[model samples]
Target: MSQEPGWLRPHGEPWKRVSERLVYDNPWITVTEHQAVAPTGKSAIYGVVSFKNLAMAVLPLFDDGSTVLVGQHRFAHRDYSWEIPEGGGPRDVDPLESAKRELREEAGLEAAQWLPVMKVQLSNAITDEIAIGYIATGLSPVPTDPDETEELALVRVPFREALEAALAGQLPDVMTVAMLLRAYHMARERALPDALSRAMLG
Candidate 1:
């Protein structure tokens, strides 16, 4: 008999699940408690938060090298926040559509171009929340139709300044921070258009 290739084998021993219970359920999230056996043969209890939708964000870039940010009071954090246009995309929907809707609803902007920047996990240790980020250009005005629950303020700032704010911890939203940093990296590495990159760098 031929031996199995190392690459064909499992990367690690799988956890043996003993039991799982639904701890909580909401429109957007579900929490579950699980009892499992570890790879080391030790029993463990774990809690996992699962999201019903994919988190999506967009960095709207203008021809002038400026970007739009949305400011609002976050109830969960009980603080004011400035972030890129972000919202939840239903699992069955395309994330780009969600990003476009959020940008229009939050900032009243529409884009002729959309470049997906990154996909990431928000909190792997505690939550199974995934986020997709995009850079939107070729912009135009649109009518804002924000969620009634949102009381938002729009701010237009130079891309570099926004990035600086994000780096300085002014923008605490994970999606915003990561996307801003990614944009900066892309500009510096010439991953973006020369004109656009030059405008943003300035």
Candidate 2:
């Protein structure tokens, strides 16, 4: 019998928690401070931010190669930001439903097709915030009811133009930038429908 390789051996050691305590919390997020043993045997204190909901974003692509973008003043950055429709969905709720609602609220559009494209960690170093991206097509106009706290501007532009802006740092929202690049990649690689890809690339 051949001996098992060292690489094949189980390496299931996780960060051993020594102690943990709640530092702060709100309806949206919770901060926890933990004393833990690292995999390499070092002991340290870590602060983690836990999100109460999952972030969801939608890229609403039209048949004419245009997409919808929403502009708003972001309180955290203290500046105006242009981004694809996005919102928070409760962990217990379906992300697709949240995406749909965001689209309707932000862009006044409804999509007949939805393709989940990516899942990402927004900030691994300090926050446990997960975001999901979707490509939405077969769109139609719908009534919009934006949240009372939001004062938004909507822009419809060619997909290529939006992508160029995102690449050039005009669109700083992480989800929008990532999803635009992913959509461009899909178009170049023919990962989407033939007509849609052709329209987007052009």
Candidate 3:
């Protein structure tokens, strides 16, 4: 009989294991394993899942002060999602480039100016997906080139209303909300009193 693949072999419970990762080796992130004791004092192996991700989302702010959003389906959540132009790609791609691509693909809009607003982690307590948020300003409409599988609608909402939706828990995708919040604050940072100078500077 042939031996099973090293990664297919069991390391712990049926669902958890120190399996070979399915992503590239990026220096910013990697996995590690260690032994641990449960609260019940039972011994088990812990597999730390890690990888640096390039998650870019854009808030396309028109000169009119209305922001553009893209509505797409999220099969993982079994719901249609309305979000900023966003994507998850290999860490190899320039994050700003990813933002530009996503903006054009999803909303058919491009900005004359791009601001890198936030570099945040999805959930540092668990995964290692780093999200890069951007504020896209001075917009111009263009022909959309969405992925073949995409069926999306471009929406324009006022900046204040977008902020309200994000804060009122109406935006279901936490990641989108988080990034939009950052992008919004960053877009308005110049007008504010420069309270978060470091964040605004970056």
**lDDT (CA) per prediction:** 0.93, 0.94, 0.70
lDDT, candidate 3, at 42: 65
Candidate order (TM-score): 1, 2, 3
Which runs of model 3 end up more than 4 angstroms from their true locations? 1-44, 47-53, 187-202
Q: Look at candidate 2 and tell me the lDDT of residue 193.
A: 93
Cα-based lDDT at residue 50, candidate 1:
97
Residue 146 C-alpha lDDT in model 3: 88
Best model per lDDT: 2
Number of clashes in model 3?
A: 0
Clashes of each: 0, 0, 0
Question: Per-residue lDDT for 125-151 in model 3, tens only?
Answer: 557677787777768888999899888
Writing each residue's lDDT as its tens digit, candidate 1 over 126-174 gives 8989999999999999899999999999999999999999889989999
Could you tell me which 10 consecutive residues in candidate 1 have the lowest summed lDDT?
6-15
User: What are the models' TM-scores?
Assistant: 0.92, 0.91, 0.70
Worst 10 residues of 2 by lDDT: 8-17
Candidate with better TM-score, 1 vs 3: 1
Give every collision pair in model 1.
none
lDDT of 2 by residue, 12-79 (tens): 67788899999999999999999999888899899999999999999999998899999999999899
